[model samples]
Target: MEGMDKEPWFFKDLSRLDAIRMLLAPGNTKGSFLIRESESNKGSYTLSVRDLDNNAGDTVKHYKIRNMDKGGFYITARIAFNSLSELVKHYSREADGLCTTLIKPCQTRIPQKPWWQDEWEIPRESLKLERRLGGGAVWRGIYNNHTKVAIKNLKVGTMSTSAFLAEANLMKNLQHPRLVRLYAVVTQEPIYIVTEFMANGSLVDFLKTNERRQHDHKHPHRHGISGKAQTLWLREWRLLKRGITSTGTCGRPTSWCLRTSSARSPTSASLASSRTTSTRREKVLNSPIKWTAPEAINYGTFSIKSDVWSFGILLTETVTYGRIPYPGMTNPEVIQNLERGYRMPRPDDCPEELYSIMNLCWQEAPEKRPTFEYLRSVLEDFFTAQKQQYQTQPC
Candidate 1:
């Protein structure tokens, strides 16, 4: 067989001046070049090109050019651009021209609402302590005539009020079905945050209830399990597992529980005071220390990846129907076991694919752990295929 003619190769590694020089070179107009501002770095741009005789289609070469005097260069990939000017225009809305290091402010900015105010407050008399959630206590209250919310009260002297406020600022921006909704913050001394109440309690308890219902021989309710409810269960699992990274805060709830209506949101209120040890707080709260990720336990460093590691532990707990992670193991024992590459055994009857995901999340190196978005995509596809297979089966 005759070999296919090789396509023209653009310079994959080029300085800002060199790339511009290439574009200005003779006969370079045959193909399109895409240029966009690099997302991770301001004043840096990514240039992607598709030659006239393209073999890879949208799979074009990418080069990062730092235009500033102190800027550097790199190579990356994405989609090809139609024209250099077009790419410049796209990025120009929020940045300077391709050759400059400055970025322009976006024309529109999201207005930050004042979360703490006396008018939006929950009266002390109306607040009733309900249950322990994270590092705080949730109190049931009527914020207004038709608004019933759970108030999360922070312990005095645990965290600075500024830290709490900063957390509230972040929390107020977050809105997702998998996350509990924040109504308002009572900024008064002994700060309290109001959020939507979930009646079904924690996710572990909810899953346990679901597991019992599945095994109930005397009262079969499989037919009563509406598609919506099943989807909701999957959603709850998705949110609890994947929603942390999306929030830009690696804040995972002390428990991966979901209420009937909402998943508990993580805030500074849920974070143990900087002065205290999480293990001590865990003991005080009577929450399991085994769920703490190895990195967190060993180095006291927490990140989004650390939270994902905790999710792996939570996955084991959920699949096992409230069974403890690292059962019969002390915190120190669990830490030692994990450092030596020991992971929890697969839950009985758990899907191999699901277990594989849990393993990915448990990678020893934080960077090696799979992202929440990737895991969610995998699970979504797997469940979709299962649903399709069932639908195609003969009645």
Candidate 2:
């Protein structure tokens, strides 16, 4: 860490007991944390944090920060970072794992602000509901009698307020052309989330409508695909592949969104994403089972590597035009086949390169799967060349 960055309290030689004592000292609170080189291991580091809220044990706790053999670092297998600074920054923002988030270095006192700021909270009276956007919780609305906005109303009792928008830090830091712009939050009996309105409607409807038109017209290429598989053609899949990783939008394993034409840049696998690590490999607990990787389902081991596996599913869903993955298979059957090294075959008319990429994503061993970074680069090269062949975005 000294050779890397942020060394005000790196403590290269600090012992485990010293770390616990420093974290438990007089003024420290939960989330007060420090990183010290491990005394037991030559080059490894340990994260020590105070957790006064835990009634089970002593106030201070320790976690190991391990280095990935290939590259990056991780506190848990589910999440990884390119550097120690990013690892620190991520946990500081959200305690995705760990006893608590890394608030300030072990001793530094920094005033914390409420996750929701008073300024970001808008009054309900200012919003005028126009019409339902389609279904679900969203609607077209007028904000302050002038601005047209997309409004999403959520029931307060259904989920905790902290659970929904706890990532104020993540939200504030997000600024991208491809992502929908959230305007403000209305905290009332029903929580209203206001965002920029897209005049064309959701991407799903747009794409579906176009697909229906193309199908009705009897486009020759339609013969290759089956059912209502209307979302993507090979050309269109090539166009959207890069945009897939750049946005925070959910993929097929979770939720997929509509696009507004402004696509995104290629980056790490949205696989540079959120995840869970578990020990029960044979059975999946709470996650969407179909999209999960074998390592995660059987052993509870999750990482960006597992995310790569999910990305393969995301890719299949994309190319198949929103078709459910493992088309004819049940969840039990899918899991059984996956355990036997079964990967979905290439979709009809799917390019070999695209399927090859999917195969890389589907590799059974978590460590063997291509990373989001690698996938981003490969997709960019492959799709860019294909896009140049057509010279147009998806219709």
Candidate 3:
């Protein structure tokens, strides 16, 4: 047994055809071998054998001997010309002939159930109508083409044409990053107010989507890890603060910073004074309540102070990820509560620091509400402190 284990295994008599047959057999037999002519044999054949198996098994014996000594018997099978080309042809034909006719068109034409069609269509129609009649489509500034543009055929008389003219003038004079830039006013049919397009759409749209996604099962709430929910609140606070602190720059912070610095400069101070006087004159000429003050809420007047109050409400909205200030409460109810000096409490998981800031903004007296500049400073401090604490804590 020891000697057998040490013995080298070899095929005894294997013809090339027999070797090929054994190789193609279903049961594995390791392999078979063939004898062939070598150059050294001149015309004699050489015993070029190989092992069939190293393991102990019932193996098939096969052989072929070719003479080189006199070249009497030469065996060469045309194995190279096998039917490999036939397989390629077979598949090519099958693929080309295969038909994939649908029994039905997958009901694709059944009209896709719009994810938000039910809730949004009516509101969207209302918005379009409001935009049409409220002089929203009226252009107010020059366009690149230098043509005075305005949307025409707007349900005219619904909104005073004088008011539209005033808005157009206001828009023309306005050059701030936060405020939409007015190029030209065109009063063609349907009124086309050409302004810079906001790729990010509106704050209202973002708020709606955020609210929907929060409750979507596909996107469950995940906490911590920079706390994205809290981060959104912080962002809202910053935006509100920016909008409040700067004047004549719309609602963008960067634009406000640029314009504010220039306006405060000595040379710009004279220009600023003139602009201020002009603005006061315009206010007297056109007492629009669209941008009214907080006091106006009671008396139907809009002011910067009232705008700040609105900002506070907006901040609350952001913190809650678009949750209504008073869920299940009607607008009348909300207004009544406001009249009674009522404010919504912060969401349960809201940071305490944020809650405090919101409370300050909701002060009964509009004048008592912290200015945007003050709010920004407070938020900066709070954020810095929180970051420091996070860094100091052990993992």
Candidate 4:
């Protein structure tokens, strides 16, 4: 019974089901174990170990430690230990009649940081909205009257301020280099989000503009970006898309493209612009049927896997230069077609490799979908293999 009072691994009140969940976590191994007070029997304990073989009675085997009327503990009839600590120590050394010997203590979870680390609030006076960027709530504004920025205004219901800020804090932490950097938030009557300005606008708009230029014939190649540059731009977005999907989040349509020195690429303040009480958020969450996964539309369930289905839609958008998905199909027909396994054909200029990735994303079963991390690595290798083609027209 050494240092029984100081073992943080001893979780006195954790339930049986929660112990199973922790032990079966992806990070856990076969022998990971914990001792918990038995729910049905007061003053007794249960030893839970993860043993994943089907031969074992259960994936997580639980053995009851019967507390003798005298001050001692025992699991098997032949073995008796004077203390709970001694019983645990003895069992760690050998499985004896139990399922498996304990290898490590159940991992103690680190408490999530409960508050925002840095201040995010800004005074309204610091941002100057110069002009409307589109016909929307966003405006081309100057932060501190000097730094050009895009400002988005969101109306908050009086009751939802805390929820809005909590979501904002999460967005601040997950800001990837590929995303539009969120500058400051104004917590006034109409909340304002200030983000770094992108002169060209969303990837959808930028790509459409170029697509039109190519179709015009007179200005067939006047988009000012080389073919190699466009390829690199899309490559960067594949990286960014992975980061976005890792968060398991979806947001309002953003001015996703940043006009890079070489070409137009996607970057977003979409995370910052998800204002919970606002009407815009309502529209975004109720995504058009074409953009939503079948599971999402049918069962109203969303997970990272569902987002993968949407990423397939985004892939089509990228390949076709932002053409509306399932063109000419009504929402009802779109859902019907999706249920019948109707996947979009590869766009005219999309490479076979890219189309294959889209197919992976559109897997009918959620568990069948590949993760964003897998997608990112695949794309990196794909681009590397094609590296020589872009070398001549270096951007």
Candidate 5:
């Protein structure tokens, strides 16, 4: 029963043919792929996929649907070619378009090199293991003459080598104060993703620890959030929120981080910052079921809109002092409820404006959810209003 329950309902209930059609649907198509159907002389239907706009040249493939079994269509069987790649090449035709120009890579990204004479390699003896940080483990290490940095050692088997490189490449492009600083990627043996250490630990843990300390205080109000802390929290929140959209780091909740005392100019937190579309997709297949978006769970579709949903949950967790988003609900229960338009209630004392953002994020249709850019503007206004309200108070 346990084994059966873990099985993906997608394979059991949905057929391969139907899934293919769904993938080509208007909502799913991102101009990279297109499917066309026509009638064949032999009474079978012919379907062809036009795969273009990738780094590779244009290609198309045609196949006829003739055989059907309990598992649905045996699509590749009817094609002249043995492999999918071969089939694409058979029917491929030449084309020239504006999109082709747009799809080209701009320039080779140059990552910052280590100042030390010895490349980016970190001596194993220098690393002092601290503790686990989700999928990766962190360690304190020194390089370039006693410069302290955090070393994130991720298991190579966790993902494909290409994915590891993609992540490293993404981090190199993402330069922000609120986001962690990527020093260099050490690819020897187990992958070491080097970054600046946050001595204060993750914001999630920081908040949880603060909540516990406050509860144990002699004077509750005295230990209540100071103005400085409140301001810093809002500022950091804005930075992290903007950084997510700017750098396209919408993978997991842990992707967002903050330094304990470091503060950057508010001008750097503009959500309107333009970003090129990321070619790489943050693989969330193994992520916790709770944090997984509804669309991703049902159809294996993920996008920036889905990230907004996760962000809403993260916001809820932040305001509630690290409380789980759907507390007391199982994964199946959460999915069922979400499909029926169920949304989590606002955390206790959560600001009305922030809760409104949460409601927007939980909209049934992904299109209805506000973009991170939109959220950025709304948050700026929210913070402005908050500061004004505090000023007007009879303090």
Candidate 6:
């Protein structure tokens, strides 16, 4: 009580006083004393002391004040003393209120509804052909809901509705650490495919942003080679590759390679002649033929093998930070090169092991391409090795 500015007191029933005495008895033995309120005071008091404990055997001494009104009472408490004086601290009235509230156990329980039951119903009119936003054959829009999900609506007539169903089915059946999760498929009206939102956007968006930042800063070509960038690119590529190749199906037929050697070659004269005759020359020339596998381009057929070839192009794009595989070449030229069995050149900075993997992925024969499982294992090993190297190096 030597530290008290004034005496402390509180009005309470006999039972409450007994409980407080029992709680503070241990502190009393350890040289604690209380300063009681002056007898003239009413419904107001401060409890200050040399030492006080809320509970027995606790080293911390609490200082507190209480005020009683007709309806309720307000109380505040703080640890006021410690052997290490430097460790003593104070708390605000709101903090003491929080401590008092937390002293009691919560009894409320609320059952959560299943996701399917709680999500919004898809509108049928939204799926109508005329309701499509973009003029192009494909409609792409973000479902601006709480989750901000993306939806791609391919023109029903351009590609059969089966294609959309196939994608949805594939998404549902697939399970990979890197693959985006398909939460639900609603076929009630316009088909709605629900998926988890990726807050950071796609790998494509990230690479584009990175490239823009690098150019804006006028940084050197090697500027983005930091460990963080490398790790991010590696992880993105691994996830993308896994998502595409997880299906056991092999793409385009092997026979496409046999015919590729003999496809009509486009000469400059032929290209020039076509340009003069056709208004669609540019569109014809800039088409995605080259990136398409020989079978897909020539026969209008595609399979998992063709998907692998596309994945290789995507991998190149990712590694080069959004650089097209063959810049300046027209679509026709790309197709011609593919027909001639010319693969895209690996980036100068690409690791040899990665280049080897790309070569396998870009194999002319679908059967010869490595499986996704095999690719995952190889990448895992590479990542593990890289991590070990990083750990061993001095910071």
lDDT of 3 by residue, 56-75 (tens): 11223322324334323332
- CA error at residue 127 for candidate 5, angstroms: 4.8
Rank by lDDT, descending? 4, 2, 1, 5, 6, 3
Cα RMSDs, all models:
16.7, 18.0, 29.0, 17.2, 21.8, 21.9
Off by over 4 Å in 4: 1-118, 156-159, 211-286, 389-395
Of 3 and 6, the candidate ahead on lDDT is: 6
Whose lDDT is higher: candidate 2's or candidate 4's?
4
CA RMSD (A), model 2: 18.0
- Find the 10 residues in a row with the least total lDDT in model 5: 260-269
- Residue-level lDDT of model 1, residues 16-82, one tens digit each, is 3333323322223323453445556765566644332232111124456545243323232232334
**Model 1: residues with Cα > 4 Å off, grouped in runs:** 1-136, 210-212, 215-288, 392-395
Off by over 4 Å in 6: 1-145, 154-156, 175-177, 211-287
Instruction: Please report the candidate that would top TM-score against the real structure.
Output: 4
Instruction: Please give the TM-score that candidate 2 achieves against the real structure.
Output: 0.51
Q: What's the lDDT for candidate 2?
A: 0.58
Candidate 5 residues 1-395, lDDT tens each? Answer: 12422322212232233333333322222223322233333323344333443322223334453434432333455334433233233433322221221111111122345422123334455455555544435677664545566776665454556555555654544333234556656665667767766554555565466544464242222211221232343443433322121112211122233332111111112212313212111222223446556765555555667767766766676566566668999766776787787888877777776788878877778899987667766666676676676667674
TM-scores for all predictions: 0.52, 0.51, 0.40, 0.52, 0.52, 0.45
lDDT of 5 at 186: 66
Candidate 2 residue lDDT tens string, 69-142: 98888989988889888888899888886878888876633323454644456678989999986545678999
Compared with the true structure, model 3 gives a TM-score of 0.40
> Cα lDDT of all candidates, in order?
0.48, 0.58, 0.36, 0.59, 0.46, 0.40
